[model samples]
Target chain A: MNKNRLTERKILVTGGGAGIGQECVSKCLSEGATVAVLDRKLDKLEKNLEKDVSINSTVLVEVDISVGEQVCRGVKQAAQELGGLDGVVNSAGIDLVSEFDDMNWDDWSKVLDVNLTGAIHVCQQALPYLRLNRSSSIVNIASGAGLVPIQNRVAYCASKAGLIMASKSLAMDLASSDIRVNAVCPGAVDTDLFRQNIRDESDIEQVKSRYAMNRLGEVSEIADVVIFLLSDEASLITGSALAVDGGRVFH
Target chain B: MAGEFFIEFEQFVMKQRKVALVTGCANGIGRASALSLARSGMDLVLVDIEQEGLDVLRKNVIDLGSRSAVICGDCQDEHILDEVFEFAQRDFGAIDVLVNNLGRSAREHASSFLDSSPDTWSAVLDISLMTTLRVTHRAAPSMKRRGWGRIINMSSDTALIGDEGLADYAAAKSGLLGFTRVLARELGSYGITVNAICPGAIKTRAHDHLKPSILEKIKSTIPMNRVGEPEEVAGLVSFLSGDGASYITGQALAINGGRYML
Candidate 1:
């Protein structure tokens, strides 16, 4: 409820063009943080920010985070443009749903590359700059599939679970540097990516009924958690995997 | 910008004077949480076995300009839990936050699992786990009707890491985690978030009995190389009990100075 909680803080949000990433970008700007958005789709990023006056202060970088070289250069460029970096939200992720037996090596590797390695690239590049600031943080956007197995999502689940453990290991390694790392595991958010999975109106209703809340989560709900973990309010929280599901896995 | 969302959230919370009922408010994490919640603009209902401690905290809450109610009774007593909840609903109208901070690992009773008596197990479990079960059972219905509540249970890192001579304590605390997860699932639709906070080696009255050398040995094990303050744990409890943590449910957050990572 506090405005300007992240005042003067400069943060880079990956996948900032759409879905939960877009919500994080907007929320960060509203909380008074200078933002740099990295996404493969530069046009989508531009279109999302075009209506806001804060666009003047934002740094937009076209980057495919799955590529190591691009992430390294993009992070450096964003840092230079923003003067420095205080935190990062690795919200860029890709999920490919296929049965384990049917999935090819390329499909499995691609999901791991974008969802897990992409986050690693961002953290690796941002760590040096993040270490310079006090109370710096990194928030990785994992998913409920990471904590519990989801049918037909072997690659997605494996990558997210790995990402969650990676976050904990990084948190332990960076604790001495005052850099906190945490993960958010969201379940069934109503995003374009999520909508793409549903075939019909009845499918949507069926998915909604799986959760105890009898509804899907909004992107902003997950973004709210990202902002909180990045703020000074969560100084003591690190190596924690917070589930933002509407109680979908309880049953 | 999404500034309007936060403003609306602030207004929604400010529209009513929220009430928080905390157990084991005599000292340590409980006392710190009680004070923190009071400062966050919530009226307080403090429960503890020590009458003097409750009186002291009651005065502290009143000084913060928030209403205070004190119940001097053991949390393990079912009748005491019933009275506490009745008093809360009669006075506060609806319960908004519940902090189950009424558990401890007694040094005298802690021993090798094979040598420990049944009495020790019952005492430890009754105090740490059953008390949580008793109080949460009574407070949940009111919270469901209101459509918003925050329940924080205090667990220990011992349960996570499996320390020697703390088998019963670990079992009880571990049971709390299971309870927290199931309750979070059942209550998620009702707008009530259930979470457990696992703290490691915090400086509390419980630690006053330990020798300095033993404390130093404990500190060396932590990555931070220092024991945590009670306020650090309190800060987390306050954050979890606020509107910002609405999306976080069924989480077990550890504030243990990098001692354990899960």
Candidate 2:
């Protein structure tokens, strides 16, 4: 509420066109942190946020962070526009519905390319500027499927699982530096992408029923935790993969 | 009328109120641990040796509008523990949360390995390590029968990040970590969760001699640059107790304000 918890900090949020990414963008801006939104679609991003001048002032870049070359150029341009970088939240990701055997190489590659490789790109480009800041933190949004292998999500699960360990390794590697790295593992949330992924409505209900909360997670709940991990209050927490789910699998 | 008010109050207490039995509620982390659980809408069974402090806590828990059962006995005493379990059943019905928070912290004795006293080591292990087994050994069956329960042990960041003058405490707390993992694995099928909350140096009255400058330097070492409040620790316990943390089990979570990240 002081708004100074994240004040003057510049953050880059990828896949900012919709759902959880958009929520993270608004939440960060409300806390007085400058945000750079990276997404593929200008129309979708603009449509998601409208009539809110505070959110509109955020820097929007149309380049895909999953592409190595685009990530290099886009991160530099965004940091220049925001003046400096204090944090990078790798929230850009996609989930496919196919099972392991049915999944083709292209689907598998797309999942890994966007979720796993894209995260490294953001971190590599953001690290130099982050090292300059006093309390820089990187919050990578992984998934509950990463911790416990979810059925029929082989590619997505592998990508998120890789991201989680990568975050820990990065934290250990960056301990000497002021920069901190962590990840958030969220359960099923009522996000548009999540809803669209499930073909059967009953399957969605089944997923929700498996949780102790007996309901889907709110986007704001995960957003609040991300804000904490990114803020000074969570300064000592590096390399820890915190689950922001509504107590799914209880990690 | 007084009778009508009592009836209303009794019904209000019967619904949506959680009851917990916190072992090792006598001193150090255990005392603080019980208070944290009570702050989160829990009726408390505060077990400790310090009768005076227990009285103060009993009053405090009651003030929080929850029931209180003060049991002043060693956690390993089977007879005393039986009495405690009966008392909780009689006073508050089935226990919803069991915080295995009893432990001993010995700062002076046994610093030198060759000069270590057997009694000191036994006392530390009995209070810190074995007590978890004793309490959970009894509480888990009940928790399993209910199909919803939380078992939390007050562990130390020292177990993860080693320190001087704390070999015994560290060893005991580390054992508790193993217990947590094992219990979590076995109990997951039953829908019971087991975890540990490892805390760093809090500004409790125990550290009265700690110099301000040294404390400041210590704070500076922490990324948060401040000590955690008992309430902050309580917030995590509350989360763990609720349905929101059912998916998390067998984990050692450090609430040290960023002193040790792992």
Candidate 3:
């Protein structure tokens, strides 16, 4: 596919150090957007910049998105560095794998803070710059778990489900401002986070059987969807939770 | 410069030679959708009960430089639908797009739910829902073999809002939403996208028969303060059938100009 689909746009991607977030940053850059990456770690962001070999095209901000103050400052600084913002991809997220009985209050709160509230912080900080553009968009990287229940992931599922609703609410709130908000719900993608959840070959096979595609998704598959939602191609699309989960979730 | 770009794009699409089967293609949104797909360089298999309208649309499609096979018959007839698919296979080799635009509420029976007869319910369900199910069933296997297809079912805002006095119509159209969602899930692995378009108050021949005062009142109810053009809904159908909408499936998109939001 052509990479120049996002020409002349400026975008910020949170959780850009790894997994789906990292893929979004790379794809956005390739699609001809000057990008700002916010992540708790700077190593992957630096590597992405080095691979692109154009230092001026990207801004890397080291900050925890879960912290509201850090998110506000980092988003402002990145917007300043990129000159402005046309879109934001809230791909920053954390997952906790625990049954309801094993989960504590801190575990549940941590998941919600990073996945749901973190997205809210980024949207709040980026709204000013996003509104300046006539057709800006926000793509929240939610999960298939958000739409359907998965066993042993009570907190993770709750956080993502809340994020999906938050995405729709934001879409309605921002429609008058001309900023479209949508979510991409990916299922069992072969990312760092997904690999961490698999304990053996049997687990991989089991997960594969769950999808109609009979395999895990590539990070690029999910990233391509995020890029499409952020682009002008999806102009009429808002308040939509597009499932790029190989038919795992329907909505 | 724009003209030159359009010419170049048209040539590119013509080279692809996509094939589309559009039912109820004689007038209104169906005809507009057929023409829009032709503009996108798709050869069409047009079906409608009106022969004269089909001839006109066939001429127009030929003028657009796209081949068209016109069949004048009721789409709800299983034999007619079978013949449509057979003709598509014989001429176009495989159907790349299926636009299920054959549907209508029974105007004569537009009374309260309790006042409606079983015949009205059957007719509405047969015309609006069963036709979609039958056609999609026939076209799906060919689409699965080709590994790519776009199926767009025409539903209505009544399905979403459950408007009074149109209980039968609402039930039929609402059934389409559930059908589209399940079919999308079943066919996604085969690269076939199933989506429904829910339009409200589009200016069509059916509405021309309505009293002017009633039409005006309907327009007043719309937030856009005007009735929608058939071509407006056609634009969305064209988009849903195109490459840009590959990831979108099982969605019932509203094109009612803010009259309804989902």
Candidate 4:
């Protein structure tokens, strides 16, 4: 909890405008790293700093990651502004809530574009800077839904699953370059959006009962792991898909 | 060595400490885990068949500013294990954590299953799987009384991705995954978390004895293109025993340097 794990390192976190991504960015800053946030919206990350976080320590960049060209530009700008990059957390993703029969090509492709392709874009663009440092790590925010099927979300599942496998493949290709890549699979995080979206207390209980722990994980808990994977502590942990879920069933 | 490994509780009294009982702590992963746990501020009751290594480790733990007690004996003996837990209960009230580190990735031989005998299988199962069951059986009651405990089992990634000729070892270590899940379900409400770690080729004494050419071939098969260190696995052990891993249970976490994926 002391702020020295990532001292003087530079990190870029995609989808840092809200939820788990935002939390990773703030925690990275508090851990003595200069962090840059790339997302479509920057106001939330700018205004939503923790009491211990100083906005002066963060650089906010606005860009659509789904587009390769924009990601190329955004990553270059972030690395340039922060002087270099030592880590990247791909946390920007959207869930498409539709059955297989109800899904349209537009929705399916859009989900894949942002969740899977966008992650690839950021990794490709950040590669040059990532290799410049003594060590580098990439943590992709995947979902347990990717590992296990979740009904009513075919596109979301496929996209995240693709990201997890891609992360493993990338770890192999980049290990010689001294860059480590891994994925984090979270199950039903208690984010602000997740809390507001659940309709009733009974609904919450129903979800809780499904997990062995009978509760949802907090965003800070997820960030604690991401920070671990990014630090020197996890040097031997490349190509792992760590599940931060609260003892969800089957896994 | 001639008598009991236990020191009389009547001789010493101190404030309550977070005690972690790590079995097989004489060398390899077990020694590293005990030292790491002590570094994390946990008092230790170190168990192993050998006494010399445990004494060295106890001094290391004491130097780290944590209490360390040595219990040297074979864990397969239930009476010896019973005394370990009994002393832990009377001295520290109960062990807060247990690290089952008796499993060793066998380097005795790599003969095919056709050449393996059933007798060899039983010995492998006894040391890797049954020993952990005995220790857990003794440790669980006191943990349930306190409503919080952490149990970490050392499994191997070869258990998931079968090795060419390590069938018996694979079967025995893989059995740990099932045991972990069963205990997680039975102990969840009691606030105890049980999990297993499946590590790929770590540089233990076995690796040190291997020819450099053979070591290179093994490293080539892993994606990270290298073997892992004991201290690296120790870091993960430290995390799983902490409050941050409270919600995580029943998982066979692989610390392989990208050798295999589940």
Report the number of the highest-DockQ candidate: 4
Model 4 preserves the real interface contacts to a fraction of 0.49
- Candidate 3's C-alpha runs over 4 A off are A3-5, A30-32, A45-55, B1-17, B25-42, B49-68, B107-109, B185-193, B197-262
DockQ (Cα-based) for each candidate: 0.44, 0.20, 0.16, 0.54
> lDDT at A203 for candidate 3?
95
For every candidate, the chain B TM-score is 0.93, 0.88, 0.93, 0.92
What is the per-residue lDDT of model 3 for residues B1-262, given as tens digits with 9 covering 90 to 100?
9999999997786547989999898999999999999997799999999999999999999999999888899988888877887888788777899999999898866899988999999999999999899988888898899789899999998898887889989999999999988888788788888888888888899888889898888866554456778887887788778775665677777766445555
Candidate 2 lDDT tens digits, B82-194:
98888888888778898887776765464754567778888888888988898888778877897778988888888988776677888999998888877876776677778
The Cα error of candidate 1 at residue A27, in Å, is 2.0
Ordering by TM-score? 4, 1, 3, 2
Of the two candidates 2 and 4, the one with more favorable DockQ, higher being better, is 4
Query: Relative to the unseen true structure, what is the C-alpha lDDT of residue B106 in candidate 2, on a scale of 0 to 100?
Result: 65
Report the lDDT of model 4 for residue A45.
70
Candidate 3, residue B216: how far the Cα is off, in Å: 10
Q: Provide the overall lDDT of each model, using Cα atoms, as 2-decimal numbers.
A: 0.87, 0.77, 0.84, 0.85
Identify the runs in model 4 with alpha carbons over 4 angstroms from their true place. A50-53, A249-251, B1-17
- Tens digits of per-residue lDDT, candidate 3, A1-251, equal 65487998999999888998988888888888888999999796686577566557788898898888999899999999999999999988887888777779998998999999999889998998998887799999999899987889999999899998898788777776778888888888888888888899999999877665556778887787788778765555667666766556655
Q: Judging by TM-score against the true structure, name the best candidate.
A: 4
- Cα lDDT tens digits, model 4, B1-262, are 3233334442243434578999898898888989889988888998999889988998899899988767888999988887787777676777889999896544575568899878777788899999999899888888888888999999999998998888888998899999998898788778888889988999888779989998999999887788999999988888889876777777888888888865
Global lDDT for candidate 3?
0.84
Q: Considering the two chains of model 4, state its CAPRI-style docking category.
A: medium
